[model samples]
Target: MDTKTVTDHLYYPVSAQKMDRGEGVYLYDSGGNRYLDCASATFNLSLGYSHPAVIAAMKDQLDRVVHLTSSYQSDPINGLVQRLVETSPANLTRVHPKVSGGSSANEGAVKMAQHATGKTEVITLFRSHVGQTMMMASMSGNAFRREPFPLLYPGSMQVPDPYCFRCFYGQSKETCGLMCVDRIDDFIEYASSGRVAAVMIEPISGNGGNIVPPDGYMQKLRAFCDEQDIALIFDEIQTGIGRTGHMFAAQHFDVEPDAITTAKGLGGSGAQVAAILTNERLSGLPAHHHSFTYGSNLLAAAAANVTLDIVRQPEFLANVRHTGDYILERLRDMQLRYPAIGDVRGVGLMIGFEMCEPDGKPAVKLTNHLASAAMEHGLILRTSRYGYGNVLKIRPPLILTMTQAEEICDKLENLFMAELAR
Candidate 1:
């Protein structure tokens, strides 16, 4: 099980040990070393590893049918799509299912918007990560990720993120009046050809430092898009399916987008399910414009259906909100004790804390050091290495308990103290 010799060197220094099994938020290595998964294994396993319900659903589905192309209808398709729509925003009534992964979900979404509007230009926030596919990667805002590639797909434009903590526009949320939204008019007028189809935004920026846009910022974008007749696409590929306490992070903003991309946690426990819930407006895309070979896989759909059934429960979401608030409060307390802890922000289980120096600049080196050190402490912590090497991404499974939450904090406290003290 030597991954280094077998796989690409994308994630360098890959773990030598192989994880044999996972159960209830903890993963056990081949040597029986237990590791607490704080990042939900790339934020995909919403219900934690080997969630009983998710596994049961998958086994049940595999017995009936394992794989089916979307050309023909399947038993779980309608039921899963129905449950998804019921839990999704009211405006998004149509469902386009795709076999797992966020990159595919976002690529399909952007295609639909372009197809429906007969437009060519698209807009995304700086630092917002759309996906890993060629077209989607070109559309992303992180320049570093796309630097080595030769000429990505064009027609994608960038805008300032509503990062109030480290405001890109150098203005405070209180007095700035949401300048990020105000710049769209100029970008479309001067930068674009006016054939803009959609403006894709992360209700909460996932890879972009876990940034939560200021209040009224999201509503402003929605209204502006309406005035301009542009489709608003919310990229909740990382924040959807109970990651943010809400079934979708779009709900937390109290506004709706024309379409929303979902993946990651939709399958409950790393099941392969990704989709784009769209409105009737964007359903005009041609039959084969945004198709996938295994788009409506029954096995993953079965797990996804069960996952949504449990996550969308009112009581389950309530518990998430309660527990998430508790975790946030504890993180804030850590901020008080450790000046290295710069900022804490996020909703529900999708939380992040930025590491900073005493003078308030991002402690990039310290963050990298601490993240690596935590693995030795038997906890796999997701930090800004994926984003920018400053913020720690702390998204546990939706099924995490209070005791597990405390363990995470305590473990991190030691990791931070040891690494940041010197």
Candidate 2:
């Protein structure tokens, strides 16, 4: 049951050890090794593992039905769709469900945007990662993923994300004047050429190390997209469904995107479900152009409906905000003590720390070592992929308590100290 044995035998060895089960914010290996899951199973599982309510909902729905094609409207699917329409921003009413995952939802969004606008070009941030699909992979900025699949989908362009930590433009966060948004303006001016239909972005970059843009940046970009008659798409795969102390990260900035794609936490650990929320304007597009066979399956819809009901509550979100603030404060204190900690960023429960060498270069090797060490010590973390993999992502489940947060922070602090001493 050692890590070595597990990795050697597992089919796809992404983990140090094979997980036997999970409950709340913890994952246990068959050997009874417990790990505090700060990774949140790749930033999904927002409500954590095996919530009683989510399990009950799934079980109850299983008794009634499992899969129902979108061609026929089932009660669970219809009811869930209606709830999504009602809860989303007024302008965004039309709902398109996809099999649970970020990539499919993004694919749906791209098709909708193109269908609505009759344009081919899609622009996104340079460090952004949409998904692994042929089209989504083309839109992603990760070179490693796209390198193998050469000749990815055409009509995709990359613009600089507003990464204040390592600003594409040489400007500080305080005095930069939100040049990141202005770069989008530049892209619209020179690159758009009336061919660009959509500008997709993460309200907060997820796998790109939870990089949060400055206040007003998202709003300004939304305004720019509106003025240019381009559809604004929010890929909230990691930031939606109350991961960021809000139902959607766009809500935090008060920016209503033309379309928003969400997955991960949509099923509340019950079923696989993802959805694309768009306005009537985009939905009015011919249906034949954009359709999925099993998007609104009955079981997925029921699970999603229950998940949304729990996440959308004002009191629950307020708790998230409160817990997030406490975690951020502790991280800031850690940053002061560790020179390797270059930056601490993100909103709500989605947070990260960028590790750097003493010379200020990205300490990728050290970060990987630290993560391995942390896992050995019963904590799980993630590395980012924005040029360097030194950024440590700390996106735990929303159901995590302050006590759990404290334990995580304390363990991380100990890890940092131990590594530095070594």
Q: Which runs in model 2 stand beyond 4 Å of their true positions?
A: 1-11, 189-193, 386-388
Per residue, candidate 1 scores C-alpha lDDT tens digits across 363-409 of 88877777778888888877763736698888888898888888888
In the order shown, the candidates' Cα RMSDs to the true structure are: 1.9, 2.4
Residue-wise C-alpha lDDT for candidate 2, range 1-422, written one tens digit per residue: 97678677878747445689999999999899999999888677888888878888888999998887677778887877787777676788888874457898888788888888888789988879899888888998877878886577888888888888888898998998888877776776687665788999988888776789898898888888888778999999988888889888878878889999988888787468888899876786565665667777787788888888898889888878878888899989988988788988878998888888898888999888888889877899888883367888888888888899899988898888788666
lDDT of 2 at 67: 83
TM-scores of the models, in the given order?
A: 0.96, 0.94
Measured by TM-score, the strongest candidate is 1
Candidate 2 lDDT (Cα, 0 to 1): 0.83
> So what's the TM-score on candidate 1?
0.96
